[model samples]
Target: MAIVTMIRRDVLTLPAAELGPDNPLPPLRPLDEMHRIEDRDKEDLPGDMARQIGYAPLHSLLPVRVRDGYGRTRAPRDIDTLVIENDRLRATVLPGLGGRIASLYHKPTGRELLYRNPVFQPACFALNGAWYSGGIEWNIGATGHTTLSCSPLHAARVTAPDGGEMLRLWEWERLRDLPFQVDLWLPEGSDFLYVGVRVRNPHERPAPVYWWSNIAVPEECRVLAPAEEAYHFGYERRLRRVPVPSYDAVDRTYPLNSVHPADYFYEVPDGRRRWIAALDENGHGLVQTSTDVLRGRKLFVWGTGTGGRRWQEWLTEPGTGGYCEIQAGLARTQLEHVRLDAESEVSWLEAYGPLSARREGEWAAVVRGAEAGLDAVLPRAEVEAAYAAWRPCADTEPGETLAVGSGWGALEVLRTGDKLPGTPFEESTLGDAQTPWLQLLRSGSFPEPRRVTPSGETLVAPHWRDMLESAPAQPLTEYHLGVAQWHAGDRAQAVRSWERALQLSTSSWRLLRCLAVADREADHHERAADRYAEAFDDLCQERRDDGESWTAATAALGHEAIEALVATGRITDARAVWHRLHPATRRRGRFRLIEARLLLAEGKREAARAVFDAGFEVADLREGAESIGELWARITDEPLPAHYDFRMRPGHDDRPA
Candidate 1:
């Protein structure tokens, strides 16, 4: 056998609900608003590194749509998958779901190298929202998981460096407005899977770039990286440098030894190879190595604490085993974004496979053995040579189309008239989502929908905003123009635009919600609450079961309205709005929390406590959020339960109520 290399289409029967309609609200908050990690505890950092942490910050997620529409409800559904395989290894990639490598199997040992998530549970983990845990995830565009974590990406067949058929995944990262591609191939009879990744800047100005290859490995493995010191970022929102492997007298190399979820960013030296590994006691497990352009290496461990275990259960089925993430990135840490100059592209090749290290004296001894093992089998120079061979192939046109991504890429291409080599965002791929913007690009005016159903995607790019400004001053145009103005940091202009839209009969609930956010940001809480209440009412009245998309918008708006009302001491009105919510929406875990908040606001402490006793899970709880824990503390003085104890650090009392 000449080492079989082929790609095939397959189906996976999973209990996953479709990520329903994306939230219609333009993401008003900055991407890092909740993160608040800049210059955090910088006393322990090098001066240069501290400066990079705050550089090139993204103000908001304007052009990208939020994907909070998915719910906990799931049924047996067929999910499409593509398998790229050679004789020694087989990799399953979900092209429709962010081109996620769902599983990688080593054929000879009958072992799974990556954490193969047993269930498809959509949680609020990705940057835009919906995210599932498992396998090798290609994270590009910005920090956290890419907005494309649960979205589709274009996939096609291309010639590999070894003359084998490779699976290529490409997408337009809307937040950064960059085109990127990931090529997956297993060379003839090779144990390691090769990945070629490229991110290109087609614009005239410089742009910040962030890329991380997040690989999920089983917790049974010990994480190893080439560094003596590591920068630790805990959920407490603190960053400090600490010794590797033996931090706080607990060998941090073992994922389970710690008691909280945290990230250990290894400071790979200027001349060292970029690599990280998770290996078992027998020293046989997955190792990831990359070329120089990808500089960062990290180990994200959800440790042995109850909260970590609970998060593990929350991300998948309750009984599934826990896992850790070994990631490689372009900066020293995920919190930092490197600047990519105009018309420049960054490219690198990464290889992942099983390695055997036959030594076990200490952490250093184990890491040295692992490095020796890697060099003996697949040397660092070989990886560099492979990257050199793949450089020219990166520009080769895609051969056969396997899947299609969002039409936003094609719309961008239409507006900019830039041909992204290799990753073609063809005109034929345009769809309903791109209709209004496409019309604006061609006719020089945005077409207004007949019904004020709060439908259609919003575009906030400068080019689109300029076109909207030039278009007729219709309510729709003004509404979108306000969003663009807000994104451009012009709050006064944004307010004027929304007010102008409201002057017309075609004004909508979506416009009202945007104005409410502006008011809230401006510290006009009472006025903001009124706008939120009105927006929710209008949204509910107009939602004629219009579709799942409308329902998601309704739920989002209602949630915001209730929070505002409760915060402003409008308990009676909040209750009224809560009752007006659809029964199904009221049954959601997040809604249950809202109901508890309402109970507490109404002076029913015992009832609010009973809500926790009833045992509900907020499936979409954020990583660093203290909302649930804080609410529990407010309701009672008792110790938090194992299921609810997700605190990653101390000083809970210091947090504001």
Candidate 2:
């Protein structure tokens, strides 16, 4: 019953590219067919996805196919429903219109929780459970459907966001190295056992519906989305799965059975895609989901506690207990994608089993062409090697929205959603509560974890801080409060909170980036540069199957900053700061235009020109860069242009400049 909203920070509509044309580039190798499909433009325009476009599930143009030169198609299996039964529980997977698990009926207690893993953070379900209670995990919203599973094949339920019939089953099929073919494993005990629904577009114009699988799960879970690194809420983790953080009763208390402090918010490189697999404590399989398929995917690991860990707690509702869900993807899509076109069909796959589902000792899922088999085992080395070729975008790109200098300086804006370029908080604010406490925290105070006395009174302010200091400050709470403070306008306070947070938590690249940004904002350029550099080092250390692009991007940003200082004729300052920065932070987009300016300053006019010529005009100068309107005076050498209009930035409108 949650409202999910997708801000198309990176949403892009790619025009369909003609396929099957003879010999454009060297003919794609017959063995590398998957690569060809990826290169091909999507049939459905990859437009900016936002709130659910329509109630119906999203579909594709035609049945995706996977063709191996050897006459093999790595397609996923079709199933009516994948039932996972064991001593403790029973659940089923039904594929439907959207590639998701239709229903999750916890038979042990007759309590059914329907959700998806839009972004794969644990503590998904039982938000109102009787265990840990806090709004930490409530950062995301529920969309049309949520998929569930411990393997490549997912189980999901397609629900009516507007309170109508809410149930459907689905799974995704993929040929080894090809796009996925979603297979609807029709629901059981219902009329949709084998029949797939072809949803029609109800509105005349395209509608944008926010949809994502709200995967509900316990607090003691972790993810493996291979990216530069994974962040919870905004905190990062070191390991994919770690022990749950202990609940510090002295900090601010939330609802029991809730994921507080740390909420998994996986940061994937733009245009990169891949699947994330989740495992339990015993290293046994638990759940896995994927990001977009075109770019090589990466894993985002998130949890609570020191390092990357989760806070162990039980999920008990009015009657049920110990349940959770994971969410994945942005919440919205254009109505066109949701309303099934007459000839369009959407497909995916879902498979599940107890901890002992697969006994062959193979511990991974393969994503390829349409053909996907649960029991299929290809060379693990080959999978990693093939995927490793692709790199991810840097996580430090300008916020989602970007407005480069138009060809004519026409003030052109390419907007997907309301987020500013290079901003990450836009997505993190999704489902977070606008509570006064949260509001105050967002403003400046980094609230420590809640503390409850023996009599059970929630602590706040001085008392909360006292409790946090008395015991170990919960990393998640500290980070959440720090972010809250940052949003609330106390940049200095937020920086302090994050510094304290870093002491207890380790292994989050995003946090490292945040620390860098926070220090920069405070004009502590040396510290910020150092932090960014450290993030790059950590990124290199945690290099997984995917995510080099983002790492590169981070480095790019740092370098950009240095380049900017140098361009503005501050070489000595730039060099001093650059030296202080870690090698990783010095590599990529850290200072995009700033670098160009620096090159210009150093009299490397051609190099500077190259930097500018390489789509530098298109560079997102909005992040710390002065806005066009702000720069008008400088550029015009006169009063503001008469035709120019100005307004404050979205979230900063009311704040002082």
Candidate 3:
């Protein structure tokens, strides 16, 4: 049977704000206040390995904008989805949402190979703030999650090497300024679905590259990789080498063997086919294998802990059971960023299918059977040959535009007519976000949108930075240039830029907020609070209710300003900022939490208790954040609800009586 592809409607609920417009402000929090959640830092040892781990740690996500505009409300809306199907398998892709393969269903077995998240609930997991769970997530860019986790990608039909139709998802990764594509197809009479990935650097500079195909699998399986030693990183923020399959006298290959969240990056040695499988007791589960260049394989288990279970529940709806990640990446560890030199590309072919049941009994036997099963389906030699076959196909132009992604790539290509053969970020794809940049590209000047509003974007790419630097000076220009400079780690120049921007427009709340962030990072809490208060007040002073897009900015500034005031023990000032918020904005879940914080700061335990009693949900509450539960316990004489208990540490959770 021939492969078929079509766009269908899926109810896109759970991402309440419709994965709303990105926060106009850059997403960098004060470094001092930012808890280092990722534990990819090297362990202290007397070796060059330790030195290598620190080689190019991403200090900041400067060029990329934060995606925090999505909220927790779950209103249903229609979203277009591209579905590709064959007689044997069916794959559903969300081009509007990071090109996530939302489902891979086996027709013969009637099983969902990947975790099919019933809802699109986004949490604060991506490098950008909003990230949802389940399916196959293609993570690229510097560590953590990709900024594209919730963003759309350019999707279209392309001719496969076998003359079949394939769905291609391409996007310009502005974080690294690289164009990449993922071509997915299922061959006729073949059980294994083929995925060809290519990332190209059109620029003349060495770019740090990271790619990980993270597949969410059910926890009711044993994850087997081609390594006996694994780098284990747990919630305590420590990386230690431990034995795979069995670590600390427990066989951790089973996802339930642990009690906390952890990453087991397998040490897939040289000459080994890079593959990992999550096989059930009967050795029937999903197997993912790729060619040599996509080298790393890993198993990320949230473990059997309550926090882990709670996180699983939070990402989807409660009672979705649990799932772990079996990932394939371009590096041994997610912390390590491989260098893709100037004008080069890296391409690989990956195959994913159900591992045939081996009828093995022991765990060791089941693992070996799993490996043998993969070899039977798609041998390493065949995978390498598939990579060779897909090389010329990588240059195949997209046939029909199935969906659209961001216009960042089109904006870049417009600036420097770089021709990427296969993935064309077309001129027509340029949207409102790219309009300002397009004017800058054509006129070498940025439009100023600084009256009672924040700049919609704060891109800090070297080219854009240089463009802004040479543009006619304005408050917006100076403010954006300062952001670029700050991201490039030039704090002094960044501060000067913001200060000058403020000089041009004294009441520009955006400039004040940027300066306030600089002060906060420098540990000047009082000064930061003062700046934040001024910024919030300035925003309020310039409101025109006739309908301007100031509500998001006002709420954001007001939230930050109140938090800063409360943190610095200025209770009255915090209350003033809170009340200054638009009534509609104040009624939102996050602001209610802020109101509680304000009451708690003023020694009003009863008032704080009332705030919780009033029942509010902080929609964008991050994973493992126990702040709400901690606050609840501190004020109210009641046990923390299961809803707010997001504690990931085993013993630190606020369990109810």
Which one is best on TM-score? Answer: 1
lDDT of 2: 0.30
lDDT tens digits, residue span 1-657, model 2: 222311111121211111111110111112110001111222332333221222333221111111101101112333343442333333343321122343444433453333222221112122110111211111111121121111122222222222122222212111110112122222222111121221112222443222233344433333334343332221211112121221222111111323222333344456443343333444333333332331222222222221122122211122222333444443221121233233232222222221212212211231121013212422223233322321111112332121111010010011112221111222222222223233233343433334310011112223234333344355655654455455435667766767776788654554566677666655667666666556655644554432333433334434534633543455756655555444533332324344555554566667755553353221112111234344333323454332222221222122211
On residues 346-447, what C-alpha lDDT tens digit does candidate 3 reach at each position? 989999888865633565576566678788777888888877888899899998888889888988888899888998888998887788888888998998
How many clashes does the backbone of model 1 have?
0
Better of 1 and 2 by lDDT: 1
Clashes of each: 0, 161, 0
Local distance difference test, each candidate: 0.85, 0.30, 0.79
Instruction: Assess candidate 3 and give its lDDT.
Output: 0.79
Instruction: State the weakest 10-residue window (summed lDDT) of model 1.
Output: 648-657
Residue 322, candidate 1: C-alpha displacement in angstroms: 0.6
In model 1, state the lDDT of residue 311. 81
Give lDDT: candidate 3, residue 295: 83
Model 3, TM vs. native:
0.93
- 621 Cα displacement, candidate 1 (Å): 1.6
| Local lDDT at 131 for model 3 | 91
Span of 10 residues, lowest total lDDT, candidate 3: 30-39
